[model samples]
Target: MRSKIEQIRMSKKNTADSGIDIIESPEALASQISRAEIFFIKYKKALIGVAIAIVAIVLAFAAYRFYIDSQESTAQSALSNVVYAMENDSLSQALNGSGGNEGLLAIADNYPGTDASNLAHLYAGIALIKQGKFDDAIDHLKSFSSSDLLVQGRAYALTGDAYMEKNQPEEAISYYKKAADYKSNEFFTPVYLMKLGIAQEKAKQPKDAIASYGKIIEEYPLSAEVTNAKKYKGLLEGEVGE
Candidate 1:
């Protein structure tokens, strides 16, 4: 279990350090956030079961791994603080620590092999991205996994966003494509497509960008991203003389 978890972390770091944004529309940010909450709630219930399995793997089956149940709860408590900081945009405090509670780095480091540590990696990655630590964000985000498609898929897109910020649009496009096509959900799929389209445009693949945008329009017509998708696709189409 320890080796397996490390392998996932290493994989993300290797792809990101070796080679390697947001919602599209102004009006959609609010809607996107609400929908994202719904997604999180839906998937979180699923992840609880996965977390149980992970606990079993780390404790009962795995001989090499070690952590206590209380530690897991403690790590989770600290992680909740980190999430609070992240939600409130207190990036520095979230990444490091504040007066009372612990931060993500500590929880993740101290509670290695636990599911809460994995979640710490996810929240830490997001906090790092907000602090402009793109490469580090990729490393942290890659360590995370959940049985929930929404969470895991967003992790892919988050790394893509990190790559995009680093100005490596091709890597960004790759991850964004992974995110856009991942699981095919109603909430995040269109948003991921918008991200993919923008990355395609950045990489000077206008045709591909238009295709991604068109996917949003055709598949997720009611999505908030669809409006911006049409807007950007029209501009790209005109530029391509079509």
Candidate 2:
């Protein structure tokens, strides 16, 4: 009995020495609440300032988003009129704006970060190409960017065309390769590959030209360009054999 009593006393003493209270007293809980209240009182102004700063930041971001949306809407509206002019073959009006509508160049310049601005660069580049302004066409085409696979590929091909017009077959070959390789698909890749082969041929690279045409014949056999590719590949192979 004494031993068992001693064991109970040892357990209680060990628990106390460990400083771990399983049941917190009312006074301890009240003391904790008081400390928390004091802390809040001491930093009340700072905490309020932080909250106000966060709210201001949120409001500022919202305002900026709204402003951008409005700008995009205006730009899209303006760009549509210019596109209509282009479709109508009114190149001068499309570029220079005959009436109140801003031309493609103005839209591109006025709205730098908007999607409409980016598309304006593309339309302007194509217009410049039509005007035989090869250098300007290349510059505007290079400035344009898009996530759409078809548009981006077309831009690359247009850049190649501009370079080819400038009598820079090597530069044209590089851009044609980019167009052919980027997001290769059945519809567009064959067209770009044909352009690549032509550029390679002009650059005195018959072997590379043959390979490009072979790719179209083998990989994109159903494409309209496949027949042209086969003809060009045969021609290049004959020239290479000599």
Candidate 3:
């Protein structure tokens, strides 16, 4: 009897160590099921409310996304209709609309928070520049934003041009530097660097202007700006030496 009792204890110990739970009787199993049912009954209302809340939140987010997508689509369509005026060089019509078609300025104003609205700002700024509205061009260009490095750089360069036209060499230098350094490439960077060098020269920063031109000669030798860069750099270096 003593040996049998020891063996039973040892079996229980091994089962516990192995994490193998054994239900001793049907009554115990039934009791556990009953307790689980009781737990469900006690929290049924709260559990249902939580599930409903999760579903409502998901639906609300989906509806909001759909609304935003619809608004963007409408704005893009409006932009497509009006961009022909810009292409045709009808500056006034492009900014103020012709007939029933909306203009770039109108699209920009009406479709706030849309990609098309941002592009409208760019178009309007360019039109303003062509019309000799330098201050207005700067304002619209400042409002325009882009993720594309090339386009954004071009906008910066254009802003520099506006400032230069206004005889603000310091402001022109700042924007030209941004255009030159923004994801610099051989093709466009040389152009921007040339602009920067000119602005720096006008600002009486001969050394800085020479360095800007030197970058074009050394880094973008194949660019069209290379010839001009060399000429400018030589002139500035001679001036500094004198």
Candidate 4:
């Protein structure tokens, strides 16, 4: 029923339509990859440099940490003799080198970044405080840091004590407040509050002093500071009324 020429024309049309999908243009594909290839070639050296810098920084940090750990171990070993001297009340020997052994000062100096060095600062500062060398005590105490709430608060309080010894009531009041508020535990809080109240009284702030004492009575009644707090508060109240 169909003509031969008409069937041949139909076959040719079908073949032409399918050919468009079957074939891809080489120019279009090359254009897509050209930008990416150029970018990588242009920045290759800089990329490698950045990678090397990053690795160096990481390795340097690891080495620094390893050095600090080693120093801490050495410092701890050196500090044991100083502790024994301190316990025996050889305060001078605890600060300086005792006999052939290293003291707190030497340990702190030799191992500056270690935890044991920081601890040595605390002990040396307290020993200086015992010797009535308030300025030296403050210097060492200021250099000290601690994660323990009790010890850190005590350091703050002792710094306040140094200020008090210098008759600097305003400065003393500030540090006493820091100690009282640092961690707010049952033991040191009441004691620090007592010191704060005394400092407030010296600063001629009877109202503030009384309030500080009242905290001891209310919050830490079981503490030894409670008795002194009551006594001081009553005395101050009587004076304020007058």
Predicted model with the maximum TM-score: 4
Model 4 ranges off by over 4 Å: 1-34
- Candidate 4 lDDT for residue 117: 95
Q: In candidate 4, what are the lDDT values of residues 76-111, reduced to their tens digit?
A: 989987888899889989999767889888998899
Global lDDT of model 3: 0.90
lDDT of 2 by residue, 19-122 (tens): 44323566666777899999999999999999999999999999988887888999999998888899998888998786788998899899887889999999
* Distance from true location, Cα of 86 in model 2, Å: 0.4
lDDT of each: 0.86, 0.90, 0.90, 0.90
Better of 1 and 2 by lDDT: 2
Q: Sort the predicted structures by TM-score, highest score first.
A: 4, 2, 3, 1
**CA displacement after TM-score superposition, residue 67 of candidate 4 (Å):** 1.0
Q: Of 2 and 4, which scores higher on TM-score?
A: 4
> CA RMSD for every model?
28.2, 5.3, 5.2, 8.9
Q: Candidate 1 on 91-151: residue-level lDDT in tens?
A: 8898888997888888878888788898989988988898898999999988988878799
lDDT of 3 by residue, 1-242 (tens): 56988999998898785443336556657778899899989999999999999999999999978876887898898888778888899889989887888888888888787889899999988999999999999999999988796999999999999999999999999999999989998779999999999999999999999999999999999999999999989988898893
